[model samples]
Target: MTGTTPTAWQQRIDTLLHALADARRDAAAAQAREVALLAEAVEIAQAMAQDAGGPTSVADIPMRSLAAQIGAAARVSDRTVQKHMSDAVVLVERFPATFATWAAGDISRGHVRVVVDAGVGIDDNAARAVFEDAALEVARRETPGRLKPAARLLATRLHLVPLQERHTAAATKREVWVRDLDDGMAELIAILPAAIAHGIRDRLDQYARRVIDARDTTDTRPTDARRISEVRADVFADLLLTGHASPDVSNDAIPADEAIIARVQVTVPALTAVGADDTPAELIGKGPIDTATALRLAGTATGWDRVLTHPVTGTVLAIDRYRPSDHLKRTLRVRDEHCRFPGCRIPTYRSDIDHTTAREHDGPTELTNLAHLCRRHHTLKHHSAWRVRQTPDGILHWTSPTGRHYPEHPARTLVFTTEQAGADIQTGAVSESATASDPPPS
Candidate 1:
């Protein structure tokens, strides 16, 4: 205050600026809370709808429909209502009994959506069981409003599966065609798990290797029963392995086993401060890369960081790398929860890490430099004018070079209203058509 006396007008301008900042901050917080509330309401409504089956009763009105009603009453789109409703589902899924206990206030729609999505893909009965148990536990231990994390924790414990990738360099047990199955008529062999099949294939490959080794080592002239069995297994395995390679054998063939998804976090240069809390900053995103490609990225040190045209803002800022921090990775995962491409729902868990800024241009390895793109979109990004931008709130906004922009809806942000297209609400529906009428319902 003593640095220099401001002119009267200057002091008024400074006060006005402070007031504006306070207003903006309050408005953002309010919007977030509103979204959270709408989400919770949707969840309760969805739970009732699921129980009643197709909203036949007053209590059974579908969450989306209920949201639509709310939207209509409030002069908003049913989609917005459903979005809030989905948030409700997330909340209920997180804190199952919150709908009844905190039904009047506190809990918001976003919390519900988080829970609902966390519970999705799990069988319904199983999900319900998990939800009820988690909800009760949360109610007893935590305050009424803190149910979201509790529900997520419960679901993770109940429904999460291990994501370990097992490697096998050896050949597995395989099928060898026997021309003289003439001794027996038509028969089907038993089906087996991949591990079992792999073991068999490996054993067969070993036998073949032995046969070759033996033949090459000396002038061997042996034709024994054991040898014959080994030979048969080897032949079967080879045939199974290379059936497609030789059309004369059969069109059917078993492809070599390869890991479908791989996750590895490497320490790379950090680019930006995420927030005031977390230090040792991190960034996270995913993409589809072949095993070889993934290992190559794994090998890199500095990684990538650079600025490019932000699809939304049009302003440029340094993009960060998606590297060794769980929080950063989680943010990217949620943003790109699936590939950052329109009409694609391939979840981030199965995607590869992509650079929004081309690496050749000296982009640093960072989260801003990365995005979760499935194999298809990862390739498409290189092939087309598709651009992806991650908003500060963690939404991925995608734009085609043609100027059409689309928001890649996160599963956590989904609303299950009749307003969504088809029965697959995950595919999403519209509150109203963008330009005019709806797309005639695919």
Candidate 2:
């Protein structure tokens, strides 16, 4: 009924496969002849894929359906089926032409998936090419069994380099701290290389995600040197489990040495309870405090809530203005080890504190309202509507001026670039050499 005709190669392979099926059917009916060749044919097909730089095992499949199919056909367990399928893949790669002919139109999505999975072993382009070419040749020939030797021989001739396995001693140790904003927090020091700092931040992101994703939303995890606030509980219970928490006195909340001014929340009744002689310290953003001012604050307010300087200043830059209870300084250090703005990689602990919402707008000084944007990003946010906000679910939402939103996850992959002496000297830091390298996915 159909006018369309199949390609010559397709038709030929289809016929061979049909014949093989018929033979298997006959064997099943008679129950006298061996069906080993049916399995051998499938094995040969898989080998050809491997030889052609495709997957040869069931592990490649996120859902190992191929292994299931093999198990069903062989009347074996799924694991057993996978083993045979893997062997078949290896064999087919060795004998390309034979396996290629039978698989002409059988390259279904599942088949492709299996092939890709098996090819994980083949890293180099040249070796992958050999496997690919062999698969094509076998598909054209539709040959099986004897063809496997060719793939094995091809693999032998090829210089298959072993993949790298490095032990990074650097990741074994980590140092994080939280303290008051001292002169060190303001005065600059030698900064780490941006790329290196980014790599470290990426690694930390990976660690946090693995643990954090498991936790339910609405619950926040503590970051910074004060993560130990839970071990001792001077902070609130609900705030303890939240992603943001305040530091305890033992955990770097040192005594105020300089009579530096800060804001405090006082109860209205409590303020009135204070004696007439009681005088409060100078109010931050407001002028100095006297008995009259204290009495006024005590009378007007239920309790006193003001900012005070902590003795220590190890990691924290400053307390957020609006959300005094929440730690905005530490959030930046954890979210972006360096600046989140593109290209600039200033360490967050060293960077300036920025408000996602302007002081003019009533943005709270919470983790949601603050980001550890580097100086460049701080300027960009001030000048441009390139908005950066954190979702309650702990994701950075960056919207362009055009109103396009991009949700960015922390980078996890590490890229190592080496320079080779050549005509193309792209960057000054590292030479862009086409070395035999296969860095993992970023």
Candidate 3:
């Protein structure tokens, strides 16, 4: 029935995996065993502390020796061991439902960690139960990152504190720091407001994508071959050191302050924008953000599009251009919020609006035929063996060079990238660095 045959090593590995199915099923029970055992160890250690002395907290220490001993045996840092002990105890004691599901091996340690971290702040029994139920439902079907929005939403709903007040207080702590590393590497860290941070990254991504798109599509003898991640890093360093991305790549030396005029796709619920509720607005490739920030951004936006979605399933149904632009271009941007390629999150502002079927081959310029593709994927589609087709429903089904199919759905959103406010942010102050870094190579 089948012409293909597996190699010996592949067959052996497959057989081994299948044979261990029952062992995998017992993982939940094993987790229970470990958590119970470790929890008991914590209890005993506490008891020993009491016997050795009064006021169980000794020299302002708590369970350090026991954790250190466990760490030594487990070959991990004592802090890690102690954290594990605490998580295990918390899972069994504070989050019984989460522990039960995790013990059943339905969700992984990552999911458990996200749930615990999100719900730890909740003390009210009724609110905690509500959050756990909502969070667990999301945890079942999504990755830890995806689950964060629902977790945060539920946690926020439970909190009595108004989001606006909390946001104001947290906004005071923004700062930047740097740490030198090995191999001529250094970590530049900034604790910025979420929107600003995400916008900065989005700009970097867009800038890098443009260079990559040019490299792949250009007719000239292209010399630059850096990957997007490498390009982003280089751009970051060059911009900081010279107030511009390296001109060597694309002569993209627009000053960083000028370049700070970045556009980002933000999906704000209708009610959330008007301050009706605090359901978080989302940056498409990014996660949920506080609604106050969303309102502030939306208030001063140059223009925006109103997208209507299916009320029940959240499927985008229609898009209405709020600002005057080519309707087709705006439609494609909202529908293909990011690249149509599977797993590529490059946004539309920096990607090509591509024809799924080539115009040269009698493919018409129509909804069913057009899709957004980042430059890299566009190049791959035309120059490489990879193939893609779009359905009338706007799903881009891609067949890879190796014959695997991945279907990328149109972004399920009600609104996306707006003409951002603060476009006049100036790089004039940072322009002095242009003389510090050497000129772009000839």
The models' CA-based lDDT, in order, is 0.44, 0.38, 0.66
- Please name the candidate that would achieve the greatest TM-score relative to the true structure: 3
Among all candidates shown, the one with the greatest lDDT: 3
- Cα displacement (Å) at residue 30, model 1: 2.8
Instruction: List RMSD in Å for every model shown.
Output: 22.4, 29.4, 10.4
Cα RMSD for predicted model 3? 10.4
Candidate 1 lDDT (Cα, whole model)?
0.44
Report the C-alpha lDDT of model 3 over 1-442, residue by residue, as the tens digit: 2555445545665577666755654875687778877787778777777667766247225478888988899899999888778877887788888888877877767788888887887877666776787678767655675556447655755655655677778889988888999999889899977778877886787677666777687754366768999888887777678766766644443433544456655667665666554555665545556676776676666666776654322444566554555657766776676777765666676588788999999988987899888899889899976788888768778885545576666655211211121122232211000000111111
| Candidate 2: Cα lDDT at 163 | 11
**Candidate 1, residues 368-419: lDDT per residue as tens digits?**
6677789988898888666777654335678755455666544323211121
Residue 345 miss distance in model 1 (angstroms)? 27
Kindly indicate the candidate among 1 and 3 with the higher TM-score: 3
- Give the range of the ten consecutive residues with the poorest summed lDDT in model 2: 431-440
Question: Per-residue lDDT tens digits of candidate 2, residues 69-181?
Answer: 65677788978765655555553554343234234343222333333333435656656565545434432222222223223322322324311111122233434445557
Off by over 4 Å in 1: 1-13, 43-64, 91-294, 298-442
Candidate 2 vs candidate 3, TM-score winner: 3
lDDT of 1 at 394: 39
